[model samples]
Target: MSAYAEITYEVEDRIATVTLNRPEARNGYTIRMADELGDAMDRADRDEDVRVVILTGNGKDFSVGADLTQGGFDFDPETGPDAAWQEPAGRCSKRIFTMNKPVIAALRGAAVGGGVTITLSCDYRLASTDSRFGFVFVRRGIYPEGASAWFLPRLVGMGTALDWMISGRVFGAEEAKTAGLVHSVHEPEEVLGKARELAREIAATTSPVSVAVTRQLLYRMASAESPFPVHELDSRLIGGLGSSPDAVEGVVSFLQKRPPEFSMRVDTDQPAYLPWLNK
Candidate 1:
């Protein structure tokens, strides 16, 4: 409920919606926005009342990358010793990657540079018909950030990732869909509604702990050396969930032909073998 200068956070129907509020600036990415975003994500992850998250921007554009008015301290090598050499966008992206709840990005208008890379960590991206994505770092004489080097290739493919980032060209939502970057594109007015509908569906039907465990398993095992590790994880998770209360409800509801009333909470009821690799 706290006010954020660069973003707005609201929770309704178990879905936490984080809106980038700099409409006049086209939601220009800024250090303050990044910090606020990190805080918002942490709030969502820790709130048991929240089951899903939707991230989007205000006004015509999702984001136009960072604000150019701030000078080049972001790219300047001589800024300071305490600058930490970390891209601000990485902090927000990492938060999204580690979230227990599903994240859906509703992108409209232009999503260029950091705009595109930041959304890469989201579980799903739904864009507007007028949306355009650009990895314009190359054109700006910089390199890609937000850990896109790893996520981009995995989401699309090495070939598509290279073609997009290396070229630094702007592409439409349809091309983004063809490249596997976006799930669906809608009219500008309907994009947010579509994202919310998906979030509501997930929040209304899925088991929180199961969804959390599944997210971690896929993300962790994708780069795994072999399928054996995944198999092992699968067995462990199945063993833990088979007798859980949620599993019992899941089966009973199915046999009775009714909606499930899953009671497990992600904050406290996640499996004992969470972060499965660490186990």
Candidate 2:
């Protein structure tokens, strides 16, 4: 709800679009941009009507990464009102990582370093055919930020992550898709449109509460050391189905061959017993 100077947040028809508005600078990343992005994402997440989020930039490039022209030192965290200090990109990535709703990234032109890393947590990435990607930290005599080391390998495997990070080479969209780093590729002008189509599909066919719970379960439990905890949690989730109106609607609608009219809301209907939500 607060005003944003560096980015734009707009919601319509159950989807929220958060855009990097600095097209003139190729949407260069900055400390202010990072804060604005984190706030916009949090705003969308808190809005019960927003079932999905589309993240993209204006103009040709998604971002040229951090704006080193004005001393890249500005992106690092020395201290803040929050109890802990986190790198700017990490702050955005972490917020996206924990969201109940799905976040999709639409990339075009150049998306290197922090630009690409900041989007690593998005559920889907739709890249423009002309998109260029890189993890060019080593070549620039710096380390990668945005907790990319943890996110990159999980998306593209250890071997590929190492190859890209160690070599610090830029690659095109097809290679990114082939390696599972991106979900799909589209024409330069169609990237954001494709993202919106995908968002609308999710918004139309899914229960908000169900999507929220499932998204959190996958991210929160994917790295677990064992399956015992997951199964235990799964049992708990399934047992709650008896009390879930959406669950019954899902089955009844299928039997009747009709579009489901689910009545669950993410903010109010999520299971109160979830460990993360409870904690």
Off by over 4 Å in 1: 71-85, 276-279
Candidate 1, run of 10 with poorest lDDT: 72-81
What is the C-alpha lDDT profile of model 2 across 94-205, one tens digit per residue?
Answer: 8899898999999999999999999999999999989999999999999999999999999999999999999999999999999999999999999999999999999988
Question: Which pairs of residues collide in model 1?
Answer: none
Per-candidate local distance difference test:
0.89, 0.92
Instruction: Give the per-residue Cα lDDT of candidate 2 at 20.
Output: 97
Please give, for residues 1-279, the per-residue lDDT of candidate 1 as tens digits: 377999999999999999999998889999888889999999999999999999999899999998867563456556564646677888889889898999999999999988888889899999999999998888989889999899999999999999998998899999999889999989999999999999999988888988998898888789889899889878887877666999999999999999899999887787666664233
**lDDT value for model 1:** 0.89
List clashing residue pairs in candidate 2.
none
* TM-score attained by model 1: 0.95
C-alpha positional error of residue 47 in candidate 2 after TM-score superposition, expressed in Å: 0.6
